[model samples]
Target: MTDIIEAIERVNGVLVDLSLEAFENDWQRQWLVERGVEIISEASRHLPDDLKARNPEIPWQKVAGIGNVLRHNYENIAAAVLWKLAQADLSTLEKACRSELAAEQSRGRR
Candidate 1:
């Protein structure tokens, strides 16, 4: 659980540092967008099903699927889509991860 939270936090931090403008350059797209997706995909793969179940809003399957796409079909991936996902979609997952961490901490203190 802590590992999941930590992973999410790390990805969130990386996403925070990125911007859509970075996708304009081919190198930036490969380094930032592609690598970021790879990191998130690996992190998401390690997340427990029980924890994932708690966050209904997140498309857990799609999250995992993106990783597969990036890994298997790297050439087909769109930088703009990845950029959109990083800027918009990730915040929801990050918020859910933080909420779960807070709930866990509260339970621990009790």
Candidate 2:
């Protein structure tokens, strides 16, 4: 929810200016993005199924699995993968989060 949206914004903010070459070389930026993904991954697990159903495009299982990767197999993650995710995949996820939040607010109003 809000956590996921905020984390994505934080990560996207960090990456909005950097290129793949720069992202690969900057360990600090990579760490920040990884941390954000970890937050998104953990928060995603608690999302309601009905909310998830509305955005079937998101790879919800992979979203959860990434936290495990960050925790247990940290060495396996590459900078390129992180760059691609931040640049390409995160917007879709962020959009889903916003959509879910809006839907929840609409339901609350009713």
Candidate 3:
């Protein structure tokens, strides 16, 4: 959960400085964001089903599958898709991660 939150924060930090045009034009930023997504996706897979069920609003399966796409189909990923993910999905994912973490902590689960 902390990994997911940290990954989102890292991507958000990069996105603050980039427009879609700049994000597309810069390979480094694209890679950084993609890597962050991979981390988020991988960590999300380890979350218990009940915890994820608490937030059905989040697309948990899609979140887990994203890393597979990044790993296997990375060459075909569009810059706009990545940009949209950063702009849109990231904040929602961050909120879900934080909420789940807090819930776990309150339950006395480390």
Per-model TM-score versus the true fold: 0.76, 0.95, 0.94
Writing each residue's lDDT as its tens digit, candidate 3 over 1-110 gives: 99999989999999896789988999999999999999999999999988888889899999999999999999999989999998998899899888877877888954
lDDT of each structure? 0.71, 0.93, 0.91
Per-residue alpha-carbon lDDT of candidate 1 for residues 47-107, written as tens digits (9 for 90 to 100)? 8798898898999888878888888898787777776776688778778878888888999
lDDT of 1: 0.71
Runs of candidate 3 with Cα error greater than 4 angstroms are none
Could you arrange the candidates by lDDT from highest to lowest?
A: 2, 3, 1
The local lDDT score (0 to 100) that residue 71 gets in candidate 3 is 100
Off by over 4 Å in 1: 1-22
Per model, how many backbone clashes are there?
A: 0, 0, 0
**TM-score-superior candidate, 1 or 2:** 2
1 versus 3: better TM-score goes to = 3
Question: Residue 6 of model 2: what lDDT?
Answer: 98
Order the candidate numbers by TM-score, best to worst: 2, 3, 1
